[model samples]
Target: MALILRDIAVARGGVPVLEGVSARIETGQALILRGPNGIGKTSLLRAVAGLQPLLEGTVEPDTGQMAYGAHADGIKAQMSVAENLRFWAGLHGTSDIDAALTAFSLDGLAGRLAATLSAGQKRRVGLARLLVTGRPIWLLDEPTVSLDTASTALFGQAVDAHLRRGGTALIATHVGCGIDAPVLDLAPYKAKPRDLAGFGGNGGFA
Candidate 1:
C-alpha cells in the first residue's frame, strides 16, 4: 500500500503549524521526517494517522490500513510482555507473537510484567507491537526515545525486516534508525504567521 499526502496542512493546539506538505511513501520504503522541535512533525503524523483532521488536502486510503505508534508506549502496566503482544495481536486478528518477541529481542523478558521492566526494555516491547498490527503502513513518532545504542539497532533491524515484507513507515526521529531511507524535512512547510493568525480554530478548517 502506498501512503500519499498532497498539499496537506496540519495544526497543533488549534494553531496552524505545517502547510503545503506533500509526499508519497510506497510499499517497502521508509520516509524519515525531520525538523526542529514544535515544527509540527508530530502534528503531521497525527493528521496522517487520522487522529486529527487535515485542514486541507487528502491522505489516500483510510486509517484502517495504518498503525500509529507515538511517544506513549501504550503498554498495559499490569500485562506481562508476552501478554501485551498477545493483546495487540488479537486486536489485529493475528495470533502469533513469537516473531515479534524475537524481532525486538524480548524472548528472555516475555514473562516479565511491563511495570517491572526498565525504560529501554519497555520501549522494545512497545515497538514490538508494530509487528502484530498486521497493517502495512506505520506512523511512528520518536520511537527511539528511551532506547539505548544496542536497543536502537534492534529497532532498526525490525524496520529493515518490515520493509522487506513490503510495509511502509513514516517515522519522526532525530537519531537515525539505520535504514537506507529518504528524509522529508518539514522546515519548508512551516505555516506562515499570517496563516496561523487567520485560523478560526474550528478544528483546523478554514
Candidate 2:
C-alpha cells in the first residue's frame, strides 16, 4: 500500500511547526525525515499515525493501517520480554512473537523482565512490536535511541524484511538505520512566524 501525504501541516504543543508538507511513500519503500530538534518530525509522525489531528491537509487511507513507535519504549516494566511482545501481539490480533524476538536479537533476553533489561535491550523490545502489529505502514520517531551499533544494524535488517513483504515506513532519526531510502528534509516546510498570528500564544490546540 502507498502512504500519501498531501500538503499536511503539523504542530507541537499546539503551535504550528511544519506546514505545506507532502510526500508519497510507496509500498516496499522507506522515507527518512531529517531536521533539527523541535522541527516537528515527531509531530508529523504523530499526525500521520492519527494520534493527533492535522492542522491542515490529508493522510491517505486512514491511519488504521499504520503502526507508530515513538521515543518511549512503550513496554510494560513488569512483564518479561516475551510477555510484552505477546501482549502487543494479542492487542493487534496476532499471537506469533518468535519472529519479532529473533528480529531484534531478543531471544536470549526473552525470559527477562523488562525492568531488568538495559536501555538498549528495552529499545529492541519496543521496536520489535512493529512486527506483530500486522500493519503495513510504520511511523517511527528516533527509533535508535540508546541502541548500540549492532542493535541498529539489526533494526535495519528488520526494516529491510518488512519492505520486502510490501510494507512502508516513515522514520525520523539523526543516525542512519542503514536503509537505502530517500530523505525528506523538513527545513523548507517550517511554518512561518505569520502563521502563528491567530494561535493566541497559548500554543494553538491540545
Q: Give the TM-score of candidate 1.
A: 0.95
TM-scores, all candidates, are 0.95, 0.94
- Model 1 per-residue lDDT tens digits across residues 1-206: 78999888878987779988999999899999999999999999999999998887789878999999999999999999999999999999999999999999999999999999999999999999999999999999999999998898999999989889999999999888777899999999999866554544223555
- The true-versus-predicted C-alpha distance at residue 183 of model 1, in Å, is 0.6
Evaluated at residue 185, the lDDT of candidate 1 is: 91
